[model samples]
Target: MGVRGLTTFVKNPSYTHDGSTTLLRPHQLSNTPVVIDGKGLLQWLYFENDVDCKHGGDYREYETICTEFIEALHQRGVKPFILFDGASNPDDSKVDTLLGRCRERIQDSAKIIDGDPESPKLRPPFTTAVFLKVLESKEVGYVFCDFEADSEIVALANIMGCPVIGNDSDFFVFDLTGGYIPLSSLRWKEARQLSIPCEKYSLDHFCQAYSMRREMVPLLAILLGNDYVSRETFDDLYHRVIKRSGNIPNGPNVRIPRTIRFLQSRQNFADGAKRLLKDEARRQGKEECIEKSLQAYHIAPESRYQAYLQQDPSMVDIPDCPLPAAYVDLYRRGAFPADYINLKFRNNRKKLLPNLVEDYIRPSCHLISQRIREAIYGILLHGLHDRAVQETGREGQDIKVFIVTGMPSLPEFGSLPNLERMIDLEEERRKVLVMEVLEVDHGRVQAIRDDLKLPVATTIYWRSKLDLPVTESGHHLMRVILLGIAICYSREDLNMDDVKGNLKEAPRVMNRTAVQAFAEWQSCMYYTMHLNTLVNRPYPTPDATKLYHGTLLHRIYATTRLQRDVNPDWVETDVLRGSPAALALFRHLDGVAQNQ
Candidate 1:
């Protein structure tokens, strides 16, 4: 309940290319800082990237992920600073409760009995030690904070005049005028796809649109409940405030309401939070004084260098390193910011389409479109134009075909002469990537490794965050279409029930999570399908009440209706401007044809 459904309220579909003169595309330009929340990223790598600590038989997988993330930022021409949570501030009243957890962590660290110096557990658990190793190896700079990584991320982003990357919804609260990129928003593979129509956003726009800093984004989050605050207590208080005041707080003049008048003198968040606790206590009719129990909420976005460096002079200095050569080439070549997808809603579908536009659909379509674009163009690159050979040993050349299978699917063809050159999918397994050799090759019974690094069909276990809506259905469906086209297979290749069964074991998916299942069916139908147009950005919900349905549900309805209105089964779409992937393919194909 961090920020409690604020994502729904702020990410309005209407705030778009059609209405606003500009949409935030921060990573598109040069000199923008990327502030990484060490915590947010660790969770993403473990969960979404499907990695875990297992290096040195001591769980060092996070190091690999940090390196990859840094590489991605470097490719966008942004040197990043990582801020890692150190200790909770000693002065925070919440510090007492956290002390117990910290004690347990200390005990946990002491218990690590690793003899190997390289063992990640030997350093410390949950303290950014592993990520530190990766950063040092890469000579990447970072901040080692004394508390609250979220606040640090915000503070650093503001100070650097740059964007942020991590999954936290709290970035919006920090007033990130530069912008923010949710790790979920990234295409993860291709560089050009970074500019997919939407996703990047400036919090300055959010503050302006919402009509208040109110200077209370963190206060709102405190009330909604995080690790320290009880959300249920706040919820009860909010209803009572609504019942008595006969007014919700979103309107103007919420300035120091009388219910919390004890705090009107300061009109600041700390006292407002104290008053909230007192109100809850009053509603409960407890004579027990809550003033002593009042903890100063510590979500405030104050920075290290900016806030205290004048006196402290203790800013952590990291060794500056040369940027990766491949990244330099990519930046010089230039990247495209997604051109706005200006779309007009059909009259009949007006109720269904609230903020449907080009930018909105970028998140869902960007990944799939890039993968499909690569799979199709890899044929031109390797099969038609021999580009793979020319680009051999180049970083980012390895194409992994992500699929899902619990068994050895590729080894069945191992006896074939052409297949002999292929690395065994069964060898050197990793999470989700049961068949991939990863970027670095490992010990295998067969000496033959993925030396050529040709676009191997990198299969991943089928999992999705469908209930989240904005990212679910379209992403799942697009993958199905991708695998289908790359291998020239149809519906027969997939077992719908098996697909459902695999995803059923995954956490965070919805009940009977049918999108991935359904995508299997569509992928068969869309085998040869290519977008005739740029994928229209999907809309988020207009009605905030049903936010759980998310953008996934919205796109499922809109995209299907669109397909029905135009081509019943064709997944191909048309656009005034080509998607980056499509545009790349056009140029590649065109270049080869011209040479011929």
Candidate 2:
């Protein structure tokens, strides 16, 4: 979707990273806003749960994704600026195609829902009105782009000298040089701050990787097609006006390299497109092909930019990268050219531009990956706060003990002998948190829970649902153990005596899908913890399979997080909010099966 065939053609993805997988602390930078993509965040929220909102969810359903994410950033000392795309698409040509794809996905969703338990469920993309309203409710800063938010976000990131946080790889095509973060990498896994580098890829590295001039990349994208334009459509446009001199055999992906060669020849797009068309026509004996190819060229890139910008002019007035509506005119008038090759030598730089011919991806590029590693730990309650306080001492309170379960025992399904090595691997990097995995596994959850003498604040970082289909008894047992600890300390905030007596009065929770039910579970947990009435909540009831799900882990931690609240006794809902599992954590398939 980025530059259709670009990622594959390049062979080498430009990136840099430190060998360490430990989470990074967010540094407070003045005048730098962490740009967020609203639609991307919505998907993260929807998928993080067992929720099935594919038929499309309403405002009340998805509002928490915004509220929780904003607060998470604030807590880490980041000023997040949100961006949403408007309902207008300047190019109407794509609606039918986009709708077609959406319909296909919706059909798939229906099959998944009505068919097998293992069928993959997909949510359909919808308008942003509901998400925008939530942003307004919280009084957060945001802007609706005229067409799409990709270019706007990149422009803003460059203007602010900050980082763009999103999942879209198209930012690579935009030449987002200053900074970029995939939104999925910012989720809360182990309660760590999201740390990503300021620069994802520079122009130099991109050119080197693709083995072509900079201008050719976008041209290749036009030929290969991107989100706005389909590759088949672009090919059709090219085939319509062309005369075949001889019916040459079409080999595998021969056009991609040929297009790259054609684009690279002229150094400038306008000159190159005309020249390529001319070259083709001379060989085919149809001189008219050049004119037809040029016409097709004008529709894309600029019109792609225009259709998006004219829908909303206020986009240009953004505080960070305020460009007037005139730029779109400039774009259309052919004032702007994708001339990376010529500009490199013409103006000239003292040094050749950046390229990663090195083994390590530059540390700057992998900042989000490292940050995501830590976030997953925190979100998963892998003693993230405990570790953060040890390193930063910002959180006044910390965990005295960890009740971690689901340590990797079997190596055959592909867990390794080195628990320490798990942190080095990408899959376990998000889920596994251990100084030494073997030591933790040896300690055992029951042993730790039974020992009970070593702690004031305790937490669970168990891989329950991921490990097994949890039963009702399992949930009750986990609740009893944690509540027993609370009762032991006589944590008056939980109203131990009162909640113990009122536990029976807590209503039965049902009548909702797993996603909605989990949301309610999270919401209730937040309220209960914010109100300091954890004990008043019902005892955990394990459903044989449902209780085994890790969704309840979020519920439990939301309640426990109040212990770190500035005023644990007072209602501070601001600090207790929803989480983005996509950003902060990742899971491994190795130990997730029935036996695991």
Candidate 3:
């Protein structure tokens, strides 16, 4: 959703020295609405706030950050519309780019484990889920686009006449009336104190500054290349039009300024487009690529996204595969996970986010969550028997792809319920179905709190699948899970502040084994959360603060290694004090694990 070098290009002194970019303030936007890039904001918020991406993410801290951010915007009277990017459409030509990013994330995860916290904040598995949870809690307006959110984000912003808040360079090409506000230049926090300096960029101002027709912007984007057409594809065109300057260093950085100057000399987009595609024999192919990329810049007066944001019932159709109305409604509302959509379109169930777990390891970390996902697939794709959802995970230093078709052959419990009526099922029936899918013994979580049942079920499955030896790290993982469940279910009995404080320690370097174990646990929880959403959320989702604090878990694991047994004493002042219910749950899980 970005033009590779456009972000850096716009920030250059040559471009900004003109009136193209101007400082904006919140007070100046009292009634002004803005559409934010949810996907971009997700990455930006997590990384910028220094949430512990190294040892898994600090979701509790992240939740707070998102909440405060939204609240700040609200205080300034900014009507914010957040838009999230969905999976790529079938004809998406960016597969190589997507796969390249996947590889990069995997490698970066390893760097983080090797004691480098500065790696590209490899997104944690449940970041989107957590972010959406915050959005709903705050009653914010948001919708997941049909495919890439760029065009739709622009479409919506154009309709509302509001600036688009994002870091994507595509905004530079779109002729938006409200212009674009890069998150990097936003001073929302400072705006609360006073009208702090912030920047807004408009295509009009840019065109005027460069003395180029506005139509040339899209052509300029194509000439520079984008996701649809690689910059290498237009190398011949760039060489023909752009002259070299010794003052500017060579690379993608210099391509923008030189290309813009050249584009300014052109009178019309048609003439520029013709010359750009006038290479040798493959002119037709180059022309088609240019048209395809150009089509992305065309914004319709009205978009299907409007209906979606309005929560209209008519906005629930997938291209070929027809999902139930109820499921579609949930999917649109952001209640349903995007994996279902990905399954229908690409037959690809996204792999869990990469971690320190070695790709060469047998029975990859994803194996721990395979059973849960199978149940999810069985329920979602029950009638579509011929379709197989592929689990794309790491396998021996390569991205492993495998088909999940074992659910149909497994021991029969109950026929897959009709998804349309699944949400309306009796609470006990829903509980039974959820437990059966999770493969948890009904008796184990029968007496547990209603909110704890689903987590306990997943916790049981996690332990059975893990089958780890008696090790301090293994026990620490179990204790952390049990403690999280206890905290969520018994917030009143225990001192919540004390509990958070106890686990509040800086992240330390963890061995690969510890990282792998936690990664597996996270995978288990993530898939179970998806299944939980599918079955109408029988229990409350575990609070991130209570369940998974990266720093706290690392601290607890380190403490466990120094002692023979894990005790509340390992941490300070009875982290488990006045929480017999939590203790009982831990005992039950430990007992189940021991017997297994």
Candidate 4:
């Protein structure tokens, strides 16, 4: 149940001399005196396997332990009430095999029976039929309980007025009370005599203290200790350490300071001490004193203290700075204190205090308005810009813009009054035409065309589909692009070459493999030149044919395949055929007369 490869316990037996009869007892049985000796008493036993063990091969160790425990119980005149949630295999017959093995160890006079009758449906390799057969033929009583399901089994036990035993704290989660004891804990020398007072502790009391429905026990552990961290932050730090240590074997351990020290000394006292100092400083408010104490302890460097002061000058007046450079240095050196390390790295007090308050006070309305503005901008750049550039053959600043305001009933257009005011300021600095599309007069879209005053023959009310009221000003820009203009497209329509050239200027965006692949794929699809020709022509010579045929196309194809694999939904087979503009240019070139 704990970490694998750690120390575990095995069961054994005991014998005692009574005045009238020789007495036998299981190692964990209570020392209470009984008038009868050699009388068969039913005993329930459970085994906790190492989680790290693989199936089949790992059962040997568990079998050995079970055998020892069962033999010890037999010598003490105790009958076995064997309950196993057989291994997670599909076969239901294995339970019988396990029962048969147990029968071999005990005296023929002593009976054995299965404790769990609801086990079959859960898909354990054993079924209830075999268990029932064994119990009836052997004349042993069975306690049928469904520990995995609802709390009714606990009630069933109370109704029967019999004792129950299992190790998990989860037993309380099922509203179980009275007659329940943890067998494993009872066997421990430290735990033999300490009995929980069930009368004072009701099922509700246990539920309130440790309920499975609430946060998990592990999460509760971190929160109680004030050291919880988020999973994302820990993963990020793990990768950073892995990168710093290179790709060498044991690199993760080598990069992590505490892990390295633990491996070296077979203990982690140095790291534990540093965390203690930090926790102490946080509580005491004496930053300078903590720094000096850490220095005296020889756990960190002096430069760290100076660095902390330099980073935040205002902290000089504050009693303590939790993030003192010395403490960070100690953390870097693998000497972090246990308490600080125990703190959850991502959601700890230090990380959540600043963000939590702001989030609690933030208004949802403001967030919605910002999101709408961003969506509009994306539609303009990605949906409309590309088609306009490709169809008109007009480059750069020749693109026209218009805005209209005056729609009243439409939901999206209703916001035009506010949107128009914002656009008014933007239009003053840019070459844009603005107009109002009235509802009653000439069609709102036609009015926009009149306002544009350009010789445009078409008129499109993009706001119509948007389900927004078509205010004259609100309709102008989108109307002109979608209807007035013969060709309309968004920034997504732009050639891949143009996008690639833009991205090359931003190195940070292309640092990751996914981003780099996107940029390259865009260049291949939109760039106006044949990439293969560009590379092959440069090295033209006797081996040019070999390079062009073998090296160049192969690499490009591989990259194309990788792009398709990475973004399966977006970059399909047809999209990778190369730049449409460049292909058209070649077609035009091929039509010219050769003799001329």
Candidate 5:
């Protein structure tokens, strides 16, 4: 029988009554022997130091969950097996100690075996050492696996065959498709059910169904948007455009007044010190001594410092202010100050504060909006439409889809009726009959019955606000197109040659230039805003020139123009490209293109 459990039981051979009067034979006969293998099931669980455990609860909770799960399996006639990392918890060493106690408690009733006999069970070895000595002396069937070191020990059950059991999804992610079976939640029900289909899903089928490129999930995440670059870039670009346009209206003149006051205060301090020194010189009976004393400190024989002090001594001793050491250190370390850091730390914090706020915080707030757009694109590409075709092996002429956005009364729905009417008009006039928008609404969508009035089979609602820039909209649309292509290719099992052939004859909706331009614009804007915040603020940097060469600005301009052509009334493009901002953006683009 295939059993999934915490441990394998070795039947005591001494209890057998087969006329072989041997003690081992009797014990083996009395119990149906099974050996639990730890090695085979190591991939099912992840062992990390307690510090890395982000989920709620401690090692005690983990032990409780495991124990309960194992007990439930035992009640269902399925054997339970337990595996543990030899390493103790980082925070508390007692995790391993407590687990050893649990193992001893269960071992008296069930089959008990030591994985590593030599390894000390406690910090100061005691009971486990005594137990190991007893088991070894008797020559019992208990096998001690060679797990002396701190590495993960894999115990392979010696029984002919056994089903591996676990509820961890990481097993599927890792593509462990051997004799594995899920101990599903349904197993805990009052009426135990044994004949469940616990077959491992084929990795190839999972990848194909999801339209995932081989081992490219991390890459896709980076491209779509990640915490590191995309967010930072968008923030940078937004601040740059805002700063260059001088749209911020609230603050005092950060540059002129502060500089003047700061300089004048230093000048007053220098003058006061000079006057006091002159008084000291006069008191010491040397009328010309103050000049000679100041002269001694001058670097040059013909000192500009002396000359400056003679003319305006108050302003002369003001220090030559270099950039802050902390800022320089941060720059060398390749970390830009976050918005809060810029606002709080460094000298001249006020001057650069607005840029940081606009760049970092504003862009971060929009990440969810961007993700929502990407999710919409994902749904259109990989959701039920592709699955229906793949499973049925039939590509229907018209696929009905329902997109539920959960927005009850968005203003954008007002335009949907007109869009649907236009699609109907175009289908009749062109006779192509390729695509259609069947229905438009701003409320919860219900399935269409045979007698329903709705003409379109697929229903998609717009729940979120649609305030995204035209460039972003175009980028999203391109992703949708790519997803559509991927889905078609995935379903048809088309080879590279077949895909190329289809591409050649595929209806050209958007040109390469237009698509490229939109992508470039989005990237540029993101970077430009990011750089402006880094430079204008008290952020650290080694080489500001190397940082802001304008590749991003160039891309933004090119992409924005393309986006403008596609949708003329987008105010963001106009706002972003206003006089000074436009000149700065164009200058950067020109520099990059020339270098290219």
Candidate 6:
């Protein structure tokens, strides 16, 4: 959602910089406070960790990466205030943008399957949940804005008199009192010392370099292209208003400099707005569009999260609805997932994660996790007027919105636990409810650790729903889950001499059958984890960091499938050599599934 090519423009010395321009200053980033864009950091950290996105995500490895990052920041004496974006417009204003991104991810996945060495990465579901868990464990300060976090982030940074750490080009338009530190220029990872060298950009430098007024920055952003205004919308306007514009190149990269030069020539935003509005035939409502786009860069004097961050809830802006007070508190603490809010307000849930499995030939990975999602949606939209959730998965042929009506009809699920009561239910009752939701035998999961129950139950459900055979493909999925259990849950019960950290090996091409089976397993875990969160301590949330490594699991799957005469010795070395107990546990779990 950054301004297209704005990052490149800002970095170019010729466009908005001189040899002595202090737009980007070399600064030390220790012993200071900064407000970080949580969403931007999430995506950056995911790709940086090299987590396998083509398969499911490797949460265990991702957790390690995030933990180390936070720890590094803390060791450098940097107090970070992280801000996250919550539900978008209830009216679905961003659906087209969301769908467009989904289509790109779909094509990227296809390229990877066709042997592209390095394709753009897709994020797996639950990546956010894992990151939040890491933050909570580290005791970092963070909050979720009601909608977009940009304005709130700017407000808080100005209030705290600290720089903002993020890569969004929109930050260039927002006038921060301290400055903005683009993540690309920050050397936070090289935390070998107390002070990390980084580059800080200030609005003052931008204005001085361009010889333009501060008020005209937003106008320039809108004209260049932003999430609100398409660059194409203003192309004709640029042609009509500018004289001798033929010198400017005709490409996306030229938009930034061209817009800046136009704004620089005018006295003010009002002066530029007057000429741009003169062309009535080019586009109707041009005046209104410019005004609306300007609002995207508005920075309020006080952020909505300001009081909440100061531990004062009275001034927080909670929505005027009958949403449970407990849920509102969770939202304030950034403990709640944004999807629940979208379902409550929009009655529409769209999942755009492109699992490599093709949607045109078979049902979406979402369909396999429908039951779990339905239960969560039931808890979220309980007494609201909308009793059904419209779920959108892939783009073509697949139904646009699969309406999931009512709660799951499992035994004792008739009166789904409301938000208030969900968190206070008895441990035994919570276990029973979660077991019912998964359609697993109570006796089987009743003995498992509270944190392990949901994942174990999910594996059982996955196996039963898919009716996977005893072939290597099916067993490979089981082996990965068991290894995860031993690592995260039974640390003392198994040896670890044979297991190495995930190797930095290129992903091997896996057969479609194996790929699809694991995708379904990942979907099951993702939805089940969310459902468990909604229902409160039903099963203690599992340690996601120990649960899966996408590359390691994929490597195991491919090795077994490729070899003609693989043996248990290979399995022991690659999957189970260090954990005889893990293999035994899986056997018992499988035995229970067989008897059931």
Task: Tell me which of candidates 4 and 6 scores higher on lDDT.
Answer: 6
Per-residue accuracy of model 2 over 1-596 as CA lDDT, tens digit each: 24565444333322212222211223323234666776676666666654533222332334456566556666656766666553223333344455455445434443443444554545422213345445556655665554456666666666566676765555555555454555444544334554322324444555554455655455556556555445554454355532121233466545555554444444555565656544644565544433432233231222122333334333243222222344322222222111111111122111111111011211211121222223222322222223221111001111111122222222322332221232234533311222122112322332222223111011122213112122222333234233333332233334434433322321122112322223222222222121111111111211111112222232333343334221222212222112122111111111111122
lDDT of 3 at 451: 61
Highest lDDT among the candidates is held by which one?
A: 6
Q: Write the residue-wise lDDT of candidate 3 on 79-158 in tens digits.
A: 78888876565564666567667677667765666676465667777777778888889888888766788888888999
Whole-model lDDT values for every prediction:
0.36, 0.36, 0.68, 0.24, 0.26, 0.69
Candidate 2, poorest ten consecutive residues by summed lDDT: 349-358
Q: What lDDT does candidate 4 reach at residue 117?
A: 27
What TM-score does model 5 achieve against the real structure?
0.17
Q: Against the true structure, what is every candidate's RMSD?
A: 22.0, 24.1, 3.8, 30.5, 35.2, 3.7
Candidate 6 positional error at 497, Å: 6.3
The C-alpha stretches of model 1 lying farther than 4 A from their native spots are 7-30, 52-63, 91-128, 193-198, 243-278, 281-303, 306-596
lDDT of 4 by residue, 1-596 (tens): 11111011111101111121211112334322111100011112211433111110112232334455444433444443322221111222123333332233221111111212221111011112223333444533232211111132243334334333554333322333343444543342232232221111133432232222221222211111211121222233235432343233452223222222222232234344335434544554533433432222121112212222223333222112233443333332222221122121211111000000001111211121122222222222222222111111101112112221112223323322222233333432111212122111122223222312211111121122222122223232222122101111112343545423322222211112221122122111111111111111111111111101111112223333323222212222232224454333222222211101
Clashes of each: 20, 36, 0, 47, 45, 2
TM-score to native of every candidate shown: 0.38, 0.40, 0.87, 0.19, 0.17, 0.88
lDDT of 1 by residue, 191-251 (tens): 4634322267775664454333444445555545444454565556655553254233354
| lDDT tens digits, residue span 253-323, model 6 | 66566767767777455664645643432365545555555776788887777666666766445574445
Measured with C-alpha atoms, the lDDT of residue 263 in candidate 5 is 26
Query: Candidate 2: where are CA atoms >4 Å away?
Result: 5-31, 48-50, 54-65, 116-130, 191-199, 233-270, 274-596
Candidate 6 RMSD computed on C-alpha atoms after optimal superposition onto the true structure: 3.7
Better of 1 and 3 by TM-score: 3
